[model samples]
Target: MATDPIEQFQISNWIPIEIGGLDFSFSNASAFMVVTAVSASAFLYLTTSSRGLVPGRLQSISEMTYEFIASMLREAAGSKGMRFFPLVFSLFVFILVANLLGVFPYFFTVTSHIIVTFALALLVVGTVIIYGFYKHGFGFLKLFVPEGVPGALVPLVVAIEIVSFLSRPVSLSVRLFANMLAGHITLKVFAGFVTTLSAFGLAGAAGAVLPLAMTIAITALEVLVAFLQAYVFAVLTCMYLNDAVNPSH
Candidate 1:
């Protein structure tokens, strides 16, 4: 029998815990998330610890990643937005590492879950809103009310802007979650096809070639997607931060 493609995403509790009738069990998802965070932090720390005069391969990688995100944030939000460098950098590293880790066999994809991605989206949007209000005071409301709008159309434009702003989190979370989930499922299905077909005989094994090829292709594509999705998330985050910093625009 072919393995179920969806089985890969099933969350299993590793260490069950309950407090005040709440299920707070440590799960496979939790474990991988911890692994992702620790691995990314350790990689960055170890790679950059020496700060060699002439950069080694590891140090070069670390430097490149830093510069990439730094340049991206600077471009998206401007120099003033560099104030949130730590937040934006951390998010990029975390999501990038988590997505890459999920590519490994038996590893749980943390961002594939809607809840996980949603929580991350909420964090970004929440930061934008809180900082927008704090720094700009009521001036942040200008984000929804653009300059040079005629009096009659002002209400309509404001309503549209408000809806679009509110929908950011939903769109952001769903983009990441859906992409990761669909890619993994497709990979799993093709892989299962290869395995099931190979078991029959010489003829079956020959037929398995197509699915095997597809599985390999999808795996490579998924790796690219892992990085792409991370970049997309970080880029959107910077753009949103720009709104907070310069609400009038």
Candidate 2:
């Protein structure tokens, strides 16, 4: 049977089960998220526990991943911001794993779904807001107010700051979802071309070769995109944390 590429994106279904008198339906995206969380935890536990002085290959790789995230956080949020290394590291690895999982031939890439990405974005952005308020109390409200604003322009600048802050999740989620969706769609379309061309005569078969080659190239590019989108997500989280730590004005 021919697969519906559009249908592949569907994530919801009604389940009869109820929890606390509330109906709950399991979703494909939800399953993927659970899998991502478990796999990430198990991976870290297994790799970190088998420690070596110099480090085994797996230990080295896992430590490298940890250092990569720690270094990125330090770079963005600084040493003072280093307190968030655990949060930032988990964010980076979870996202990187989720993104790469989608590149496999049949697995649904949860990150390609806007809702999943949006949820993650909201969590990160929400963390920044909550922590900012917790650490600074009412003074965190000053984040939306530029100190040097003239009396006449203070209201306008504050409004702009609030709007920008609210838009963070929208921008962050859309970037990952859009990039993954577009890359996968383009890849599927090219693969379809290879299929259609193979049915024609020898001349048509010859033309099929180039599309197949392009498909291979696109697959490699998609792998890079997977890694980059994860990096971008982690970095943006760090930037937001920085803003919470020290308001620009």
Candidate 3:
């Protein structure tokens, strides 16, 4: 199992802890999550702390990210959506940083796990449901009942909408988890091919060329997937929050 492609994802406890019979051990996954959060926070803080008149590269990147999320939220949920800007921006940065960090060798991809992604998905859904009811009261239920549905078909449409709404967390979590898991597994398998073949001497080294190229190509693709997944998660979040802000249809 030492060289298994899936072995890279195995969690190892660095500091095992048991509290009231509950396992709360600090494992590799937890450590990487902490690292991701700190790295992202520190980068944004340091880069923009200067408030430069003429922006540097890091500062420019930070500002672009801010504007990107701002524009996305505004477009999806309108001016009212700006209220959730801090939450949306934080989630976007956190997931983006975590995904990118996982692209490096020996880094753990926390987003690859269903549990982590599901928890994040739940948070967004929870916020939507809570805010929807709080802001609009019973009017939030209007989200499930389309405006133009015939009276007889309203029941069927409402049932379908309810099912779809309930499935958001499932779909959101699986999309990120599956993408990260599959990409990493494919990359690892090709990488292992490169290593195993190189050990077989000159003939095998020459034969390893294809797998080596594939490994590189997949690595580049994974980097793009990392960014894309984060953006997708963030944009979907904006749309969901829009339902809470304007639950008309």
Candidate 4:
């Protein structure tokens, strides 16, 4: 009867399917992920379909997004890393759209799940590892060893670096997942308070005012956060790619 904030996060099976004991059913989360990807793709295509001398509003926004990610990769990873523009851009768009979509009622937040975020993080790390070894061969190991460390402390520093490097995916995934999860949960709690307080008479209506205001403010903040988290993810990915490109640092 009462609203449960946590209920929103529960994954429910939409179209069940099982083969070879594997549960690969389509779910609300999966549907939303598809929607996010399709929506982003459609937006880009529609916005850029007509190449006008003077850009329209949608075209301007699309070009701005492209330039923004391009600038970020150039700053973090240099021009050589521009080859990864597609990967980084798609990632940023997907996360950004998914996050913003989740802010709407009845939309599932895919990034809030550890599995989804971890997969994305692992993809970035995996690309770094694969490309690093492919490009630099044994030199990739140098990423774990700094140049200025004392000879005596080299082993300790390398050990620390190794731990830190291995923890990248975990940290990256958890950062996105935790932020989305906490933000949505806090929002739901405040929103629930507004709903609960509305049942009272005049006093109840007055009580709902503060929580309603807080919810509105948090919604605005969450919109900013959606873009920020996506940008942060893209920047970090570029930085990691830079290491793979030049392991000497």
TM-score of each: 0.98, 0.89, 0.98, 0.98
Number of clashing residue pairs in every model? Answer: 0, 0, 0, 0
- Candidate 2 vs candidate 4: the lDDT winner is 4
Q: How many clashing pairs does model 4 include?
A: 0
lDDT of all the models against the reference?
0.94, 0.84, 0.95, 0.93
Model 3 C-alpha lDDT versus the unseen true structure: 0.95
TM-score, model 3 to reference: 0.98
Q: Evaluate model 1: give its TM-score.
A: 0.98
Clashing pairs in 2: none
Off by over 4 Å in 1: none
By lDDT, the best candidate is: 3
All candidates in order of lDDT, best leading: 3, 1, 4, 2
The Cα RMSD of model 3 versus the native structure comes to 0.8
Q: Which runs of model 2 end up more than 4 angstroms from their true locations?
A: 1-4, 12-23
Residue 45 shift from truth in candidate 3, angstroms: 0.6
Residue range with the least summed lDDT across 10 consecutive positions in model 1: 1-10
The regions of model 3 sitting more than 4 angstroms off are: none
lDDT of 1 at 66: 90
The deviation in Å at residue 180 for candidate 4 is: 0.5
